[model samples]
Target: MTLEIVVHRPSVSGGGRRVTVGGVDFGLARGDGDLVEFLRRAGLDDADQLVSGDSPIIQWRGGRAHEYGAAGG
Candidate 1:
């Protein structure tokens, strides 16, 4: 299955990283494996990590959040 991961810029106030799968925002931690697993269970793959910055939001098409670099930095 195909999934879209929307990674937003990290915020100190909110102090959190939000992950969006298929248009659904799944609030998650930087290294929350459970979140990736949840996405996999929901029909994703690989799921290693997701990379993002405080620039324009990035949209990646893949199976898991790992191969994408979802780990908040």
Candidate 2:
């Protein structure tokens, strides 16, 4: 199945990135750990595999992987 998960740009306040799966908002994630958990809770058992590299399942907007700091935004 193809899932469109978007990790939106980090806010200037540095709260965290907003995670959305298939247009539904899950929550904010500060790091990969939270991202993995959110994906798992969303019914993806292979969340780990999808969270790394250029999986094409995730659209990292306004930043790339490993970048979620407010100071950089």
Which has the greatest TM-score? 2
lDDT of 2 by residue, 1-73 (tens): 6878899998789988999998889999999989999899889899988886557878889986757788485
50 in model 1: Cα distance from truth in Å?
7.7
Off by over 4 Å in 2: 71-73
Report the number of clashing residue pairs per model.
Answer: 14, 0
* Residue-wise C-alpha lDDT for candidate 1, range 1-73, written one tens digit per residue: 4466565444444444556777786775454564565456555555533332322223533324333243333
The 10 consecutive residues of candidate 2 with the worst lDDT sum are 64-73
Stretches of candidate 1 exceeding 4 Å from the true structure: 32-35, 49-73
| RMSD (Å) of each candidate, 1 decimal | 8.1, 1.5
What TM-score fits each model? 0.46, 0.88
Best by lDDT: 2
lDDT of 1: 0.48
After TM-score superposition, what is the CA distance of residue 24 in candidate 2 from its true location, in Å? 0.8
